[model samples]
Target: MRLYKIMIVDDEAEVRQAIARKIDWRAVGFEIVADAENGRDALEKAETLELDVVLTDIKMPFMDGLELGAELARRKPNLKLIVFSGFDEFEYAKEAIKLNVVEYVLKPVNAAELTAILDRVRGTLDAEIEQRRNIRQLTQAYQESLPLLREKFLLDLLRGPMDPQVLEAQAERFGLAVREGAYKVAAVCDIVHGGEGRPALSDELVPVSVRQMLSDALWDRCGSEIVLGVPSILVATAWERDPVESLMRLLGEVCTECKRILGVTLAVGIGRPCQSLAELCRSCAEARTALEYRAVVGLGKPIYIQDMERLDRTAPEWDGHREQQLLSVIKFGTREQIAAMVDKLLSDGEGEWSDQSRVLGILGTLLSILRRCRLGEEAMLGPRGSWIKLLAEDAPMEALRDWLLSVCLNMSGCMDQRRVSTAKRLVEEAERYIREHYPDSGLSVDRLCEHLHISQSYFSTIFKQETGRSYVQYLTDVRMEHAVELLRATDDKTYMVAEKVGYDEPNYFSYVFKKRFGVSP
Candidate 1:
């Protein structure tokens, strides 16, 4: 029940008071917010107060009520006008009708007639509000049906190399303002799949819940976080630049709150910031790529493109053989094998990407792995992979690789979590395999599982349970201990030292050692 705010206008102060006192305003869903001496004062007050109705007398000084009514009707057509004049001239009545208010009132105004008219005004206001509300809901529904439009627009903006004028016009069509600033696209798709009790394939409400939180949290700084996800998953998109930290922080807060209240875990991928829509598209692709690593980092966390970029920078130069082996894992590997393979591929490259061209080449090799998997081609043909156009190009060595890896992982169904009961025997077998093969430079959790003919994800989980450390960490501990013993007992070149410890790249081997021992070999 909304109160229709109103104002009373009369030249004489007594008449205005008499009318105001005669009515029980609250009873009729109206409130007399102000009383003006004449139409001029009433107009000023109406503008300031944004009143809903104006009650005026035709006779007044410094602007009469009829003149005031005409002016107000032009400016605020929605405002209801009730005029009571002493003169009963037909010309005045005709002019009053043109003003388009409630109705012209005759003086001395009757209390009941004015009261009934005020009631009518309240009803009109109520009806108008309801109509507007209905229109908004309908608009939202229509928008929902055409999500592909927004997605395509966003996809084009993110895919890159579009003419600026064209992209700007497309953005305008979607009600998006492409402001000039370094905008980063964050892909929030990496949702953590929990164990048995984790809600089975989230309800559609999951997407709705996230969008609501985003609206409440981001307000005007962002557009609606359109759900760019499949039925089982919730992938969302957002682009931001100014106050990047605030955006991230707000997202993090929403993630935490959603997890607590809605039992949802979200992984956010922050892209490298870039100016212009094309670059932003590349950044978006990079974000989606970073999102693929969220599984490696576990759930309930935000992954930044900076973190992935750092990994790309520090990772050892690409290994073709290792990459081929990774492709094999993707082909035959279980969920865990694919997960561990991705981890090993990245981990082995720690501290290796030094040259830009080399990084570009390595990134190409990574994308090639996806192409071999055909996951890239599949997604490229789908609605989501418009940005996959760059299979291999100079590409600034940035997003194409990340996009490929993300798409491959998505296709591998790496999020395809297979819950296995932790078993003591499984852990013991993993430990035995590691102790025997920790010295093999090519040995990995994936390989260890393959040798044991166990599910990689299952083996890794149980092994973590028994050994209290990841297989990689446990293996590193063994190698580092041996390296320390060798450093103490005999003199060997650092590269030789690294090789004996099962690290093919001596620099990477050193990184692991320094991380463990806090000193370079």
Candidate 2:
């Protein structure tokens, strides 16, 4: 226990000395800092002394102890005071009470009584100090963990094109088991008000307790080998078997359970499996493509690219005239016309579109048109981009169609400028890469350069100059934008959303999503 500073005041020198000498101040955790023969002197000394408790005689010359106590009360409201004197005058005691004195000890102060008072004060002070320390520790811990949390989140979005070393480092830092051997990505969405506008689904908006309940429910049903990627959920299960089927089943169960128990609708999109973290971005794109289908297909369902048999085998073949016509229509068409065209193209060969061969055929047609529009050489044309290129051999038709539409919309702004046609093309290509490989959990600039056959410095410079943002910034923006769509249109778990956006770590994804949208995913 720490000792508290005490001050003694009395008109009689003998009385003051007797009290100070009689008490073993250290035994009870107190030390007398000053002694005064009069109230006036005591008041003056008190001003200069750092005292915790004051013991004073009421009746004194010049200024009474009452007056000194009143002045001390006004100056140091926190200081404790005790009154001691020969007179047992009721009036004086009453006055002491009015002055907020701690206690009134009779004429002769007893050591036992004084010790008790000091002990009580010590207890109070210790408690207050301890509380302050705990608060400081808690604040410091939260601040220190912020950066680590952010890195963990980006690593979870491992489905994009990224450097191997960077991904390995992130996995090690975050305690993530990057099963470079096999993994599957899934996109989760929550249906809200018919998907009319962006919705606020943050912890503040929906309550963290409720979000936890939803997350636990999904995890309980999906198994523990899953990582929530924010606004998307990535379930990394073994691919030795039919992983897509298993993923689809888990997604279906989650959607059904969420709707049945929480009274909220959900939709899920499962991407093709990848062998390593480098292909996460493509997985993210697949998830987003699944989410976009909600606008046309409605909610309370799951869209598995693997299940769309027809679109699974389609491939793009060059067609100059048809490609030109599609570009002209997209560039010059009215919003209504564009919407109608979009609907037609999305619905076309709805039956045949399910066929992988026919789906590839349509993708080929769309890409040719996109290419002829001179959208740029870097623009992703279906299975031609980096991330998606990895999956071109076996990707589904629905994935291809979804990828085409997504690329078109993502580069829609580029169409506004024909002079920088190359920039627009690169944006398109980047979009394709992002969609197809967002789930690799290891996509980054170094890896992107390797895929594009360009130098790191050159790639960085061109990507920034064309997109007006750093590669990471652009990727985050796109992920967050898609996250907003999922939050508004479906009732998928927050972790599921994280995975959909190429994030394997849900917590980190939520942190970044909060920073970008001013709210958590």
Best by TM-score: 1
Model 1's TM-score against the true structure: 0.35
For each candidate in turn, the TM-score is: 0.35, 0.32
Q: Candidate 1: RMSD over Cα atoms?
A: 27.2
Write down the lDDT of every candidate, Cα atoms only: 0.60, 0.57
List the lowest-lDDT window of 10 residues for candidate 2. 202-211
Worst 10 residues of 1 by lDDT: 414-423
| Candidate 2 structure lDDT | 0.57
User: How many Å off is the CA of 161 in candidate 2?
Assistant: 1.3
Model 2 misplacement above 4 A: 1-156, 177-181, 190-240, 314-521
